[model samples]
Target: MTAFHTDDPQPKPFRVADRLREAREAAGQQQKALAALLAWDPAKLSKTESGTRTAITEADVRAWADATGMSDEDRDETLEILAHFKVNEKSWRDRMRHGRRSVQLQYNELYRKSVRFRIFQTVWVPGILQTPGYARQVFTDLNELDPDTPRDVEADIRTRMARRDHLYDSNKSFEVILTEAVIRTLLVEPPTMLAQLVRLEDLLDLPNVRLGIIPQGRRVRTAPQSSFVMYDDLAIVEGFVIDNPYQGAQAERFAALMERFWADAVEGPEARQLLRQAITDLPK
Candidate 1:
């Protein structure tokens, strides 16, 4: 068997890479042997199998399958791994090199194509529902150190506005829950917060988007966790942390967690009332 080592706290990627490595070993092939079969350098294979490099294409997976004499079923399984690899890659430098605008466009495409979006935000408003002012404040906070922060800020705002279209498009369904503290905390000045409150009021009118408010008092019971977004296919969970994106089984776990949040979540007019109270309590 191919011996592999991984230090990833999340089990999914390591498990996937281990499986592929095992398959190669079962076929009696070394990393260098497999690399030679696929006309790739041995280091590339080593990096991929070790989970150091994660952006494997379908072609690479197919080549690996061919090198190992894997059956069609095995090839299909490897293709799925390639899909997960694409979804979970978190190289921010690569994103910047390719231009974040294009990356945002691709994200928008994913949002638009998804039939359902499950999101839980523990801090500020979720991007899809944020008002432009709130979005600007958020982007500014996130990009303040960069010299091109202003341009990046504008691009991010536009990207977020584009993402908001999914809420009203009627073709997609959106289920979002926010902690009461998100409404309680003022991300910007009072007037901006007021306008953001108004925006939430407007978002409540969208038929496709279901908003749940976790009351401030409920915070103790639920235990605040880092925020995450689960796509409809449950293939990705984009964490608030820059380095740690989750996919495959890890994504599924978060999706299930969102379901639990939904079960205990308040909805209907009572939730609306709580949201209104939150706005009223904000400083004038």
Candidate 2:
């Protein structure tokens, strides 16, 4: 593992949003009233106020300042904060900066807090459900991708493996849907993949876990573009490099999107058959 540049603490986007909301309230305006005054959609206003729109637009900020009767200094200060917010909010999070182990721990935090998990995969297995052998292969590959920061593949793997314990919590619910391709695809060596299949089968006995497989021949209503996990209200798109997180209305849309694929999936004993067959089909 080489030394890689790591990212500093992430700046929260909600600071500027809080300022805008406070200003609006001080001016004695309702959210709907402000939206109407600016001729903006109420949904837009809500997203902007929620800080869930990636970055709030400068035009919108100026318009908001005008509508809310914000003084010049307050308007400039808000814009300055928004400027800083946009810089950090750009779509990439380098594991080198955050450390590979840190990322795994973050997911652990999500698993601990979320009462429900909706996971969909088209390329690789979901991190939390992976067998230790399979996860080791994953991080071993990831180790080669970046050379700047001090790396620890073993530590990261341990952190991720620990996430599996959260699945045993009977009060929590796990709904995972995978395309036929995820199981069929040789993402790792046959031995590791077979072990992963065994782990998946074992998970079936858990009362709260529901595994759904959209086997081949099924019509996909939503052409799977990428894999995502909805941990209750938050949705994280597991991109090749960046992890895009969504909350508020955006997260709700992700949950709805997962439902589209869920409709085509086979669950219960039928899903188990797919796993068993995949294990049998694995190369000896």
**TM-score against native, each model:** 0.63, 0.68
- Cα displacement (angstroms), candidate 2, residue 67, comes to 35
**TM-score leader:** 2
Relative to the unseen true structure, what is the C-alpha lDDT of residue 59 in candidate 1, on a scale of 0 to 100? 78
Per-residue lDDT tens digits of candidate 1, residues 182-216? Answer: 88898788888988877887777789889887776
The CA root-mean-square deviation of candidate 1, after full C-alpha superposition on the true structure, stands at 10.8
Deviation (Å) of 259 in candidate 1: 1.7
* TM value for model 1: 0.63
Error in Å for residue 28 of model 2: 47
Over 166-280, each residue of candidate 2 has an lDDT whose tens digit, in order, gives: 8889889999999889888987999989889988888888899888999898677878778888887777777654466777798898888888888889888998999999999
Q: Which candidate ranks first by lDDT, i.e. highest?
A: 2
For model 2, the local distance difference test gives: 0.80
